[model samples]
Target chain A: MDIIVSQLMTGLSIASILMLVALGLAVIYGVTGVINLAHGEFVMLGAYAAWALQTEFGMGLLASLVPIFIIMAAVGWLVEVLVISRLYDRLLDTILATWGIGVMAQQAVRLAAGGELRYVQMPEPLSKSVTILGATDSAYRLFILFVALALFAVTWVIYRHTNFGLKLRAITQNRAVASSYGINASRIYRLTFAYGAGLAGLAGALVSPLKSVSPEMGTNYVVDAFMVVVLGGTQSLMGTLASSGILGELSGYLAFYSNDTIAKALVLLAIVVLIRFRPQGLFTARVRT
Target chain B: MSGKTKTEIVICAAVCLAILLVPVFMNDSFLLNKYARYLVLGMLAIALSLSWGYAGILNLGQATTFGLGSYCMAMALKLKTIPIHTGPDGLPDFMVWNNVPELPWFWKPFYSTTFGVTAGIVIPLLFAALLGWFMFRGRVTGVYAAITTLAAMVVVQLVIIDQQAYTGGFNGITDLAQFDVAGFAFDAYGSASYYLVAICLTASLFLALAVTKSKAGLIVQAIRDQEDRVRFFGYDVALYKIFIFSVSGAIAGLAGMLYTIVMEFASPTFMGVPLSLSVVIWVAVGGRQSLVGAMLGALIVAGMQGALSESETFLDSWTLVMGLLFVLVVLFLPKGIAGAVETITARFERRDPAPAQQPQRTDAAGAGTHHLESLP
Candidate 1:
């Protein structure tokens, strides 16, 4: 029972990070209908921002979160306006273009940061270990889990009850009809894209202390977040939350039995199998195509 | 033959001749070895073109097949080198280091040269067939196929990295012997290896061109243009996709085997994400629709990479330039360098239009229009 509790705690922490990353991807893909392969770069940029803020300005991770979010949001806005806006309906071209954008972002970071691994310092207070119900984990991990829940709650409220989300959903359902209804679909897309990017930035900033910061770190995050979004229905926010939890738990449990690399492989294989059977994903929402 | 096909054959012959004459003009063994590696990469570009261009299947995990072929060849070469490196145990050095007591059953078959050569192509072909079967049968198209294949490739990379005893972990298979047939040896720096790659590339290029021009090739193109419409015409769309995918896999495997001969070793990075994406970039830059153009794109881009890396500043900025080029190509030069050549040629031939090719332009434009609506 204690082991289960401890594993559950570990799973929750992993799920929280997955949730944060997938939230932005799910939002952008749901509204814009383009899978932003460069979304990973956005996360990487966020982590880099955190590292820079800490090293140069001596800012704590918590204090730099808002600034990193804004920075990444602006970056996302620029991407949407410059490249994604033009390739809106061209799905394959969008994938290629975004991948190019990702490569450029990675290479640019490598050049700027000199391709060496940079570490972020953990907040002193949150660095200690905490025991709850016979399960001990870093306080910083619990902090991450709490922040993820808070973000999800905020996302859920925005999506469910806000006017901006209504417009976004309306456009998602039928772009022509939404435009006819006087909704500025393009502007909504721009904002949503920015917001999603901001979420990914926050996730990256939070994760910087845990994982070593590098140009290629974003690739793994992007792949993991993609699996989460893919497994969770693409357009479903709640589905993203649920799928992350399931995947994180599965990964933690499998890694407990075997090793990290094999666990990852198995999770990917499982997702592929699931996609083979149900391409609509595990928790598909009823939306008009 | 049609005027277009005649032009293609002439171009292929010219390119092949130029490749064959590289060692003659550049006597430096180092340069010859590098050119040989580029030739293998050119073959990789052609393999990508077979599927991505003609079949409209953007296989993001193409390196999986290529890497599989490389490993198969590497394993065979490793066995031959084992007698010299390790004791009478006959195990790979890495295996012995990992405390593996006996030779794994899977490694035993690779000892025979015939099996190694055949397995290099067949294993990747079978793997691709299985993957293609699942994906196509499920009607997974466009980006879903790309993501699935990408995930599958990562899984393979992780597995290869994790199984340190069976497969070399991270460092990859090294210290391979020269690939030889009976008494004849194909040295990396020798004219024989360069000629071998040149011939293989030329043969594969012509064979690919022939496939693209055949009736089934036409049907494949039609499927790319309008998949559902072709299905309504009573064609098994999935079967065709699987066939082309597997064939592309086989070609990639052949290239991988050739890569081992030229590069002298195989590593996990051979099939990593970046190399796989680079293959796509080569096809995109060369002209996905043109086989010769894709091959040249690989050769040119790879050659430029080798040249540019000599300067420290250029090394840092090369990926940025390529990335920018890729983005710009996707936006404006959708047909790439080959497309530009076709455009110039078309203008010249406009005064005397070929009746046979009147609808080609319209067909491509129509396909573009269809693609926007069909993909979600």
Candidate 2:
């Protein structure tokens, strides 16, 4: 029983990270209608940026987050203006183009930082494990859960109440109609893309402490996030969150009993089956083409 | 044939001959070896083009099929290497270590090269057929199909990695012996292996071309362009899709056999997602929808990677360049290099006056009169 409780906590922590990553992917796909295969690369860049700041400048983990987020957000904006903007309205091309961008980013990082795994040092507070309900849990894992909740709240507020969010919703529903209403679709796309990318950057920062920081580390999470998006239904934040939690918990429990690889494969197979049965995903969006 | 088509055919033949003669002029055994690797890659690309270019099935799990083929060949080689019931536990060395008493029943037939080759093609095809039937029969298309195949790739990779006793885990299978065709010994590392690979590639290409020109190929292309319309016409869209997918899988398997022969090793990386994605890039860069374009694309990309990897200056940035090229090609040339070439040549020919137009028009009309002369 204690083991089950501890495993559930671990699952929640993983769900937190999955939610962060999948949220960014969902938002980007919602507004731009682009799958953004480089979304994982953005997370990777964020992790690397944080790693560089800590190793090179000796900055604290919290202090490194802000700068890394800004840098990654800027990169995202530049990518939107330069490459992604040209591939709009063509989903296949967008998928291919962003995949190329992903490869380029991954290879660039690989060239800079050989294929070795680098560790990130957590703060003293997060370094300790906390005892809860007769079970010990990593403080860092608990912290990630809190951070994820806070981030989710912040994203929800921004998406629902903010003017930018309003414009984004407008653009996503009908681009031509939104433009006719005098909303600059391109401006919204750029800002939302950067915002989504910033969230991915934040996700990378969050997961860096838990997992080894490496150029190809993002490869592990990319497919899972895509699965999350598909399972949740594209462009639905609620759906993303719901699916992430379900998958994270399912995979964690499976991993607890079985091997990690089998757990992952089972989750993937589940997603395929779910998509086959319910193409619109678990949570259907009201807006349609 | 008209003088223009006849000229095009002659030019294509000349190019093929030039490629064949590359080993004659290149004194370096290393260069010849590299070209041989490219030829094997070309076979895989040809398979990619048939399924993706013509059928619009963006199969990103092609490496899964390729790996299946290679593993079959490797298993046969492994079986040959082990002595018959000499070990402590009458089992293959790796299986014994993993605690299996005897060879897996499925792997038993792979002791024969002929059976191994057949299984290599048949297994992937059977898998693809089942998968295509489930997905396409239900009218799944576009991104859904892509995701399904991608998932299959992940599943296959995980399975391969976990079944370490049988598969050698991440280390994969190695030390495969030279293939014995009838009574002739074809060494894996020497010129004989290269020649074997070349012959396999050429034969695979010809078979792929033949399949692409068949009636079933036409139905597959029709399904690609208009699935609903094809269904309305009383055609079994799922059957056609499965057939083409199976053929493509077989070709990929054949390519895998050649790949193992040339590289003399097989591992999980050979069937990983990255290799699958690379096959997509090969088809795209070569000009999807054109067999010849796919062949050239694979040759050029694989050949360039080999050459560039050798140079210190190009090593670091080669992947970046390849990625950029992928993006550029997808954006600028949607039909790929072959389509671009045809478009360019047609434009140039349009600019020039036609000396013999009436006969060509008559021939075109006559060809059009046929319900289906050849598959696209």
The per-residue C-alpha lDDT of model 2 at residue B364 equals: 70
Q: What's the TM-score of every candidate structure?
A: 0.95, 0.91
> A221-280, model 2: which lDDT tens digit per residue?
778888888888886778888888988898889998899999988998888787677777
**How well is each residue in B151-261 modelled by candidate 2, as lDDT tens digits?**
988898899999998888898887666677887876654576677776676666667766766788878888887777899999988888888888888888878877877
Please write out the lDDT profile of model 1 over residues B47-129, one tens digit for every residue: 99999999999999999999999999999888888687554588888888999999999999988988999999999999999
Task: State the TM-score, rounded to 2 decimals, of chain A in model 1.
Answer: 0.97
Against the true two-chain complex, what DockQ does each candidate achieve?
Answer: 0.80, 0.66
> What are the lDDT figures for the candidates, one per model?
0.90, 0.81
| Local lDDT at A115 for model 1 | 92
Model 1 chain B is weakest, by summed lDDT over 10 consecutive residues, at B347-356
A1-289 per-residue lDDT for model 1 (tens digits): 7899999988898999998899999999878878888888899999999999999999998899999999999999998898888888677888889999999999999999989999999999999999989888899999999999899999889888999878888998889999999999989999998999999889889999999989988888888998998899887888899999998999989999999999999999988887788777889956323
